[model samples]
Each structure stands twice: as structure tokens, then as C-alpha cells.
Target chain A: MNHNLFPGFIGLSAALFAIGAVGVLVRRNPIVVFMCIELMLNAGNLALIAFGRFTHTMDGQVFALIVITVAASEVVVGLALITGVFRSGRGLDVDELSEMRE
Target chain B: MSVIFGLAAAVAVVAALGVVVAQRTLYSALALVANMVALAVLFLTLDAQFLAAVQIIVYAGAVMVLFVFIIALLSPGAQERLHPLEARVLIGGLAAVAFTVVVARLTLNGVSVAASGRFYGRLGPFAPVLVDRHGQVQTLGEQLFTTFLLPFELSSLLLLVAAVGAVYLSRRRRAS
Candidate 1:
């Protein structure tokens, strides 16, 4: 707890997370939205590790590690599904990915 | 108190602006990568070597590769551009303004959080186990496998499920 740790990273991460989330919600492209989700995960990881260092807890840093793996898996699955939807409906935009109205 | 942190913050803001204003999707992706790398460097400056290492190795190296790969697969050039204005921007703009005010308030209120990235014997044996010396693989390895094994295993399962689901979803469509 040196008061020197994390510093601007916390606020930076928050801003980045917000930007990514805004992009995801605003965009209709599956690929772009996927990138945004990845951005969001990275932001969460940054914040987690910042807290980890402040509290002297390995739990937070370790969780950040776990998040990395989960994010990688998410990309793989999410992209593949995107590709599948593309092949299935022949539509590349995410607004067309869903068949349900509600 | 402000040299490195300020620089890092500046980079973050510039890269974030790239994310918002870049007309090209590929450019946005690269800008996002820049943001991540800048963040990882900040973690290093914070003294969280483990977190820094994880940031570089995982988020920067692995996850980013996956993202770039998807972007390549998607072929950004083939996609058409969306119009500049939308209702989502209205909501997002409001949220962003609120966020700015909250952060400004925190700094103004003098609510300071500790800054060290290194553990200081505060979290029982865990902190000292990793610090105090250079060699921590044994203890870290032990804790990861034994005490925190359940979540570890669950995480692996999640990755596996995500992988399989990705494969299944990406599979080619059979002709009708």
C-alpha cells in the first residue's frame, strides 16, 4: 500500500472499459463487438490487478490471470460462432445474427 | 508524483480516442492493442510484476492475437461503414459525461488508494510467500494446485467449453 501503485491505471481502465462497452452496444458487427468485449475483459483485468497490488492480495492478480484465459476462450468461441452465423445465414452483421424478436 | 503516471494516462486517453474516432475497424483494433500495452506498462510501474507479466503474456500476447485473428477473418475491408449518428451514441455520451464527473469527484475528494504493487506481509502467508525473496514458484505452485484448485479446475472447464462451442458454431453449414 505505497500510494504509488496503480495511479492512473484505474481511471484509464475505467475509461477504456466504458469505450469498449459503448462500442459493443452501439455496433451491429459481430467482429467489432467481439473486439469490444475483449477490450472490456482487459479493462476488468487491469482494475483487478491494480486492487490486487494495493491490498497485497495474490487473489486479484491470480484472478486477472484467469480472466486472460477466459477471454482467449471467449474470442475463440465467439468468433467461431460468428463465422458459423455468417455461413448459415450468409449475413455478416450481428443485428441479423439473432432470429428472435424478443 | 506525476511523471510516469501522467504519461501513461495521456497514452490511455489518446488510444481511447482512437477507439472512438477511428473510421476503420482495423485501425481501431490496433489502437486498442496500444491501449492494452500501455496499461500493462503501467502495471509494471506499479510494481505488480506478476500482474504485469500476466498482462503482457495473456492479454497482450494471447487474447490480442485471437482478436486480431478474428478481425482478419472478418475482413474489415469487406464490411461497409455504419452511419456516424445513432441513438446508442446519445446514451453512451451521457454515460461518459457521468463517468468523467465521478472520477473528477474522487480525485477532488482526496480519496487516495495505496499505490504499491508489491505485497507487504499484509495478506497472511501469501504476500510474504511471494515476496521476502526471489524464489516463489514452490509456494505459488502449491497454493494454485491445492487450496485454490476448485476455481482453477472450473476455469479450465470454462475454457474448454468455450473452445468446443466456438468450433461447433464455426462449423460449415450443410447444403439443403
Candidate 2:
């Protein structure tokens, strides 16, 4: 078992992050955008875990756990905000929610 | 092992693309589930057994359920045309490519430096031998309770705050 798989994992992580960035940029629906953000966070977690494994440390996994916790909470609050927007009869498109832009 | 890694990576990347390209929100959620599952497999390959389980249970199981439930509840219609040829889309794609190139270069450079034995950073206490003897979960648990205890407790507090905020935000208010 080649323990030196760090570069491959890092490359995959970078690709995933880029894809998530593109999703965030192009997606208009806030929920989808939020999902993109999760994708990006997951990408970061992948990199952290890879680094941890490469260096033989548990810190990376621990940090990844914290990231997961934060992501879960973010999903909760983000979905709630989206739900509120839906209930308020506002357009679901993120662009339409730009009342603060005025 | 490399074969498995390659397959899992392919699945993850394809699923991630599906998440972005799917027109229907439900499909996007499903794609994300697939992507997360593939990532869990990748985690297992990296010797992070505990994270693999957490990734599957928390990400694929709990978080995705919330996304799908919301999609069902709201039933937002499919998005309008994605306009792949639009100028904004083109620019965003270009930017993402540039970002990926820079990150990949940095990662490759760091790994190569580490490989060349130029910098041997201090390794942690949880080496593979110790981890293998004690099991990944036990070692992680010990560290989590001791060294990382503060962040662990802070995360719990953050979760509580998030729960309260979500409830307040979603509460029904009388029409003014």
C-alpha cells in the first residue's frame, strides 16, 4: 500500500474545489448555491485529511471534524433562511433577494 | 489500492459535476449524496476510518436528508436555462480553471519539497504504529478530549446557537 498518495488526493481535492467554485458562481438558486459551498468545504476537508495522513497526525482529522460541524450548522441556518424567503412570497432566485443592494 | 483510489476519484468528480449541472434541485441533492459517499471511500483509503464513517453518516445521511426534505417542501421549479455560453459563465469557468491551476501548483510544490527531504517538520505523537495499535477512533477520541477539547466544546456551542437561530428564522409571523 503506497502511503505516498498525497499528491493524487490533493489534485482531486483541488479539482473538486474548482468545480464547487464554478457552481457557486453560476447557480442562482440560493439552496443550490449553499450546496456548492458545502462542496467547497468538503474539498477543503479532503485536503486537510490528506495532509494529516501524509504527516501521520490526527490533527487533520480533528480539524476536519470541526469543519463538518460547522458545515452542518451552516446547512441548518441556511435552509431556514431559504425557507423563510420562500414563505415570504419572494422570488427564490438569489438575485431577487437583493433588497439590501438598494 | 491505487485502482480503488482512481475509481473513487472518478466517481467523486463525476458526481460533483452532476451536482452542479443538474437542472432539478432534487437531482442536485442526489448528486451531492453520491459525491459525499465517494469522498467517504476516499477517506477510508487515506486511513481515516473514523472520518469515513462520519462523512457517510453526517454528510450523506443527515445533511442530504435535510436538503431533500427542503426541496420536497418548497418544490422550487427547475431553474431557467443555465446559459452555458453566457459571458458570465465563460468568465466564471475561466476563473475556476485558474484557481485550480494555482492550488494544484502549490500542493505539488509542497509535496515535492517534502519528498526531497529538504524540510522534515516535527511529526505528531500519533504515528502509524501507535495509531495501528490503539485504533484510529481511540487515538482520535483521546486527542479530541484532551488537546482539541476546546474546539470540541466550542463546536457544541455553535451547534446550539445554530439551532436556536434556525428556529427563530423559520418561525411563522403574523402578516403586518
Candidate 3:
């Protein structure tokens, strides 16, 4: 097992992050966008854990745990909002929720 | 180790792309589930056994189930195709690629300069600290209770707030 897998891990994380970013950019459905956001969060978590592994510390793992908690809360709130929007008959399109921009 | 990492990475990348490219939102959620599982495998390979378990139980199991439940509730029948290759998507894709390149470079540079940032401790002799069935979880629990206690308690509070807020927000309003 080669010890130099840091770059590989980082690069893979970046690619996953990019895919997530593009998904958020192009997706119209709020649920899909939210899932993409989760993807981005996972990418960041992966990086933190990898860095923790490299640094011989538990800090990165702790941070990853925190991030996962935050993401779970985010999904809860976000889905609540989505359900509210759906109930209000606004549909799930992100473009239609621009009333706040005024 | 590298082979496991490579295979997991490949699976994760493909599943991530599938999440983005799938036509139906349900399919997208499933793809995200696959991506999350693959990521958990990657976490295992990284020797973060606690994290790997958390990723599987929390993200892959709970979070994805929530997503799939919401998709079922939304029940968007016959998925509408967005105008693929549109100007906005094109620009977004380019920006994403550029961002990835910059972040990748920064990561490599930071790793090279940071103390104890070498590819050590992740595997080999020190691997047992994390990969050991009892040791890693116990260490993580000790740290969670002692060193990281404040944040741990705060996260529980956060979850409480989220639960309350979700219920409040989703409740049906009575006619005034």
C-alpha cells in the first residue's frame, strides 16, 4: 500500500464536489437541489476525514461528525420548507419561489 | 488499500454523476444513496472506521430514506427534462471544473506545507488506533464526551431545534 494517497483522495473529493456544484446549478427541483447540496457536504466531509487521517489526529473525524449532524438538520428544515411550498401549490420549481427577491 | 480506495472512489464518482444525470428525482435520490454508500467505503479505507459507520447509518440510511420519502410525497409524475447544455449549465459546468482545479491545487499545496500532513498514520502500524474494532470507537467516544463535549451537546440542541422547526413549518394552518 503506497503511503502517498493524499493527492488521490483530494482529487477525487474535488471531482465529487464539482459534480455536486453542477447539479445544484442546473437542477430546478428543490429536492434535487437539496440532494446536490448534501453531495457537496459529503465531499467536504470526505476531505476533513482524509486530512484527519493524514494528520494522525481525531480532530478531522470530529469535524466530520459535526458536519454530518449539521447536514441532517439542514435536510430536516429544507424538506419542511419544500413540503410547505408543495402544499401551497407553488410546485417544486426553484424559479417560482423568487418572491423573496423583490 | 489503494485498490480498495480506487474502486470505492470510482463507484462514488459514477454514482455522484448518476445523481446529477438521472432523469427522475426518485432515481436521483437512489443514486445519491449509492454515492453515500460508496463514500462510506472510502471512509473505511481511510481508516476512519467510526466515521464509516456513522456515514452508513446516518447519511446512507437515514438521510437518504428521508430524501426518498420526500420524493414520494412530492410525487412529481413524469419527470420534466431541463434544457440540457443550456448556456447557464455550460457556464456552471465550466465554473465547477475551474473550482475543482483550484481546490485540488490548494489541497496538495497545503498538505505539503502542513505539519504532520504526510501520508503517515493512515495505514500500516498506526492503523489500529482507528481501525481496531474497540479502540477507534472508544477513543471517539472519549473525545466526544471530554474534548468535544460542548460541540456534541450543541449538536443535540441543534437537532432538537430542527425537529421542532420542521414540525412547526410543516403544520397545516387553521383558517383565521
B1-176: candidate 2 lDDT, tens digit per residue: 99999999999999998888889898899999999999999999989999999999999999999999999999998575577889988898888778778877887788668777653355667778899999999999998999999999999999999999999999989879
- What order do candidates take by DockQ, descending? 2, 3, 1
For residues B1-176, could you state the per-residue lDDT of candidate 3 as single tens digits? 98889899999999998888788999999899889999999998887888999999999889989989988878977575756578987888788889879977987676566436444524432355444645887777787898999999999999999999999999989978
Which structure among the candidates has the greatest DockQ? Answer: 2
- Candidate 2 residue lDDT tens string, A25-87: 898988889999999999999999988887888999999999999999999999999999999
Ranked by lDDT from best down, the candidates are 2, 3, 1
i-RMSD values for every candidate model: 3.3, 1.5, 2.9
| Residue A14 in candidate 1, Cα distance off native in Å | 1.9
Q: Evaluate model 1: give its lDDT.
A: 0.69
lDDT of 1 by residue, B1-176 (tens): 36776787678667866766566777777887787777777777655666677777776688777777777776746544545565667788668667756764674343333223233325645564465464444544565688778878999999889877876776666778
Model 3 steric clash pairs: none
Q: Order of all candidates by TM-score, from best down to worst? A: 2, 3, 1
Q: What is the C-alpha lDDT of each candidate?
A: 0.69, 0.90, 0.86
TM-score of 2: 0.96
lDDT of 1 by residue, A1-102 (tens): 345434456667777788778778777666777777877887788778766665655666667777877877877787777666655646677676566766
Residue A37 Cα positional deviation in candidate 1, in Å, after optimal superposition:
1.4
